[model samples]
Target: MARIVVIGSGMGAMASAARLAVAGHRVAVYERAATYGGALGRFERDGFVFDTGPGLLHLPAVYRDLFVKTGKEPLERCVALTPVDPASRHLFDDGTDVSLPNASRAQVVSALDAALGVGAGERWGDFLNRARDAWDRTRRPLLEEPLRPDWQVLGRDPYPSVRRRRVLRRDQWAATVGEIGAWELADPRLAALLESYALAYGLDPRSAPAAAAVLPYMEQTFGSWYVRGGMRELARALYERCLARKVEFAFGAEVVAVTEKDGRAAGVELSDGTVVEADSVVFGADPRALAGMTSGRQAWAPGDVEPGPVPPGRFTVFLALRGGRPDGTVHRTVVHSPDAGAEASAAFRGEHSGRPTITVLRPDDPVTRPDDAHEAVTLTATVAAHGPVDWTDEALVARYADGMAAAALPAVPDLRERLLWREVRTPADTAAATGAAGGAVPPPALAGAEGRHLHTANTTRLPGLLLAGGWAHPGGGLAHAGMSGALVAGLVVEGDGFRGSQ
Candidate 1:
């Protein structure tokens, strides 16, 4: 059995460690922070708890596969997931509102027809059908495949023509969504919805590949979900599984470098000068951070690495309120400006406009939140990282906080007065804490026709070195990260090289 050292105890790291350990490998996970979950963790302040990252849960099958593969069932450990109807509530500046329900296509079309107009329903139906096709075509070849050289897949020449042909086919299929906004949908609202889906990947729909259209299908079909407790419970469940599998975890141990000898990974050196040697190393952190660790390595060069365009960063305001919950009881809300395109353009141009794309999540789900006396609400707004707000200046930070509050909680005029607690996080803080460059860690931009490739790492780049995080191919999000981990495990097992250690 090979000794494996995994850097960063994020969901990706933990999931991979669990799988490797279950396969009988001696797996050790090293995390920089004190906690096990990186972004999937929670912080409590003044009787209020906040998930530091990732609020919604989508694609339950990803986690299910991880648990089942590691010899545990997720449902047995975590609370049962309930479907969220009206998956999200969209509020527009012109007093217009749209609710996307978790329902049949006909139902969704009817709802759109009622909200947007007569022809809109038909247009939405067509759009969703196209998205479904994209999902089916790309899920296996692009997402599930390990993007690496494998002796099993490559029996003779590692760079075989057949493998190249498969890669090309996957790339061609992934590029289809680039026309969604410009050609696919004529209605501005429909186009906006399509664009919004792309924004989840921190990509602009106009430039995003067709593979992205798959998101709507997955969301509408599988349905968005929320854990019985907060999303952090999912991380806790994984942590529990890792323990059961006897995976060794070293929290608060930051890795400084990946040591190499004879052009192969030897192990890692920690920030405190501790050297831990292993047969293989799995880096489950941001690819940029991992690249930084190889400062003078010849196998990889810094200039060869090309990070994706940093998506617009976010400004968040957390409020602890003492008021009766809204009657409708919406779990997620997306408040859009009437001129969303203009607002997005302004933000992209590094302008701080009063209007922002706002999203709010209330901690009122009966399963997650007990009928307590207090309630919590999280308000988020997308802001340009290069905006006028001075991140280092404390006064500017407070001013920006007030600006976000005014824009987001205007309907609830007494929002500030009812607050039992308040906190703010800027892009700078998110970048530093999460290890994502510019606080917006998105995948490399979809490759162009000329194939202008980005040097960002893929899910699998080398033998025994697998990536299982937001940085991996098939890219970001809680569910995708977990799937990346499991996919890598499957690759290793299929190679017949994985053997568990006692």
Candidate 2:
């Protein structure tokens, strides 16, 4: 059995460890933080619990597969899945509002028709159908595979000149958001709706790929699901599975470097200068950070690679409030500003705009608030990466806090008084804590096939290494990250000659 070492305690890392352990490999995971669930991790403040990142859970089946593959059932350990009504409440700039219900396609159509127009329902149905087609054609080929060497292709070599070109076709769609905006939706509102999906990945819709259109379909068809207690429960369950399988976990142990011997990965060096030899090392954090940890510093030359534009980071505000829930609040709400596109552009260009698009999430259902109980609200808004107010000043943090209060809370007035406790997370925090480059969530935003060419799979780049985090391919979502871990385990098992066909 090969000794596999995985970095980071993120969902993907734990999942990959569990899969490998179940396959009879010796696995050890090193997490820099003193906890499991990197971005999926949670914290308690002022008697209220808040998930620091990734609040929503979707595509549960992807997670279920991980448990089944590991000889366990997700439902047996994790909280029961609950369907959210009005999947999302969209607050438009013109004072119009729409609620996407969790129901049948016909019901969704009826809801849209009632809100938009008589024929709008039909148009919505058509859009969903087209999106489903795209999803079916792409899901298995791209998301379900270990996107690596040209040999992993399912069929004949189509574009032999290009490497790893089996994922998508370059000429199929335009790579820029402006180009994709023109092709998919005619109405400006529709284009904005399309952009919302890209925004989920910390990307602007205008430059985000057209294939991202599949996001709405997944939400509309499968619906946005939630774990009963909280999303963190999902991470906890995966962590338990790793323990049950005897996967060794080294929490609070930060990896200082990936030691290489003769052009191959030898093992990892810990922060305390201890080296752990391994047959393979999998990085569950950002690849950019992984590049910094390599032994051959010159092997990773910045000039050797053509870097893509970094997506904007977030300015998130978490509030613990002591008051009755608002009358019209839902699980998730998107408040659009008059100039969302312009504001997003400014943010991408490292400039903060006075008004930015805002997304608010409530920990408790609006209809279920108790008489004297408090609610947890998470407000996320785009901010310029230019350090927020006088970039070099030490007081920039205070300025960011003031910015959140002045800009976000006014829109939802109860936010100020009901706010029992408040904490803010900036892009800087994400980078320092999680090693995410520019604090970006690397979801697959490649436009068409050519754009999807790069393999972000954490471990694919190195023969003896594995990648098990949101930064890898199939990027940035709890379920997708977990699936990536299982995929890596599958590769490891296959590589080790464990062929148990189902």
The best candidate in terms of lDDT:
2
Model 1 agreement with the true structure over 1-502: per-residue lDDT tens digits = 8898988888877888898899898889998777787777665666667676777777888787778778746554655567777788776666666888884677888888888889888877876776666566546534565443321221111110111124346521234343554455566677667666666555554455555666777777888887766788888888888988989988888899887766567889998999989877888866656555765532223333344555666677777777656767677777665566666675566666566666778756543322465667777766766334446567876887777677666344567777776888877777667666666645422323222222233333334455667676446778777766776566555553422211
Estimated TM-score for each candidate? 0.85, 0.85
Q: Any runs in candidate 2 off by more than 4 Å, and if so which?
A: 148-184, 261-263, 297-307, 326-328, 365-372, 384-413, 445-449, 452-455, 458-461, 496-502
Each prediction's whole-model lDDT (CA): 0.65, 0.67
After TM-score superposition, the amount by which residue 419's alpha carbon in candidate 2 deviates from its true location, in angstroms, is 2.8
lDDT of 2 by residue, 1-502 (tens): 8888888888888888988898899999898888888877565665566666776777777777788878656554666678888788776666656778874688878876777667667766776776676677667655776653342342221211112222465345344444444444444555555576667656666655556656777778877887755688888888888888898989889998988776667789999999999888888876666657884342223222223555667667777778766666688877766676787777777776666767777755432233337787777876555343233344765576666665554346767776676777777776666666656555652325444423354444456665666666666677678767867777777863422223
TM-score of 2: 0.85
Estimate candidate 2's alpha-carbon lDDT, on a 0 to 1 scale.
Answer: 0.67
